[model samples]
Target: MNRLKNCGVAVALLLLSGLTLQAQDSTALNQSEKTIKKYKPFDANLQLRSLYIWRGFKVSDAPISDVDLHYKSKDGSFQAGFWGGASLNGNYKEFDYYVSYTKKGFTVSVWDINNFSDFPNANLFNYNNGSTSHFIDAGIAYKFDFKLPLTLSWNTIVAGRDTYVKANGKRANAYSNYVQVDQVLWQDEENSSLHVFVGGGFAFGREKNFYGDHPNIVNSGLTYNKDLVLFKYHLPVAATAMFSPEHKTGTLQLVANIF
Candidate 1:
């Protein structure tokens, strides 16, 4: 009887230990699930445009496409994303990655832009000091929810191939920059109604691209956006009328969001 009682006590102890371990495992699993739920929001989009144009420069004559995928923290304080674009006709291609942090109405972002198609060498890892296909852009933006919604943004090339010779005969990183201000004309949150935006860009860079060398209003535009429902799916369409007074040109673009 003593031996049998000892065996029974040992078995009970083993069972209790097993239950404690199971409870620990359950708690760990619950914590993991909570972590995943905290950062589970994801979004993706694709934009199709008839032509690839920026700030009045025609990039491609064929169809242009932009695809983006992003994940955000549950509190919306952090985000990371991939954005890629390519021309359907030819060699124009771009791949970019960005990470951002937001607080209140302000945001700061770091982006890596790779113009792989424009690289002379086919090697993707080439980061030569003199010439490189990768550029880093740093940006900050602020939105005011005052009586009239207004947004101000600034972006500058902080690294990579953005270089130019100054008047002092020194080669230095261009640090090309652009600033813009936008006003939201209208928006309806309940109905997902139309959106109207008006904005302008001032180039602080000498690059011959979007923000040209001239110190003028390089980009000014009015955009209208609305959704079209087809088969119970919502499709967004945007129309933009952009003009560059410094370049003395205007462009009209239609964008369709397929997914």
Candidate 2:
């Protein structure tokens, strides 16, 4: 229940922030660094955000609760730590964490998930089964520059979860390719930016991709940001609105940073 409590606290805080503040979002919220400067060898951007997709928030099927904590360090290295709410139909559980690294168009990482709070209704519908499944993957990406502003990357599951979903779950694994891109527009508000994102992901299930191909999932949003000094930390604030074609809905997200 500790994980649940923490997730609840984080959600409450994020929702409360919406009430106390009114701002609009961008690049840092997603994967775009916003050409504030050029991508330098030793440049790193600290990120933090809470995403509330209109459909994700309202989904009676699968609610979306996500907290994004990522750090892109010098040498083009990146690491992201994430925690999300319960998944209704996926093998994911109360906690799913990942650590990834990238360098010069190449990337690799190890990911693991834990499901301690097995819901009573939890079945093949949604549950990783209070088990820990780990996997390692590697991939490469190309960054489009001075062109259409796009990024192309290829990845392989490389390995499967050591365990399977609950008895009501599928015995297969998840695998897919990811393609995403972002464009930065000079919006002039606290070094804010407008971004365009498009991604295609395919996962192989025990049965037949259990879910589906979900080939085209595109999102577009705006982000306003400013770095401020707060008790010895550089705080970045962002507000965003985006839409995905699959769910036929939109999302309004707000996130802040302290570095």
Candidate 2: residue pairs that collide: 24-239, 25-222, 25-223, 25-239, 25-240, 26-223, 89-125, 124-168, 172-206, 205-209
Writing each residue's lDDT as its tens digit, candidate 1 over 201-248 gives 343545343356566677777877778788999888877777777677
For model 2 the local lDDT of residue 59 reads 28
Residue pairs clashing, model 1: none
Model 1, 55: alpha-carbon shift in Å?
4.5
TM-score of every candidate relative to the true structure: 0.73, 0.48
In candidate 2, which residue ranges exceed 4 Å CA deviation? 1-97, 113-139, 145-150, 154-170, 187-191, 203-214, 218-225, 228-233
Residue 240 of model 2, lDDT score: 65
Clashes of each: 0, 10
- After superposition, which runs of candidate 1 have C-alpha atoms over 4 Å from their true positions? 1-39, 120-122, 166-170, 189-210
Please provide the root mean square deviation of candidate 2 (C-alpha atoms, Å).
20.4
Output the worst ten-in-a-row residue range by lDDT, candidate 2.
Answer: 54-63
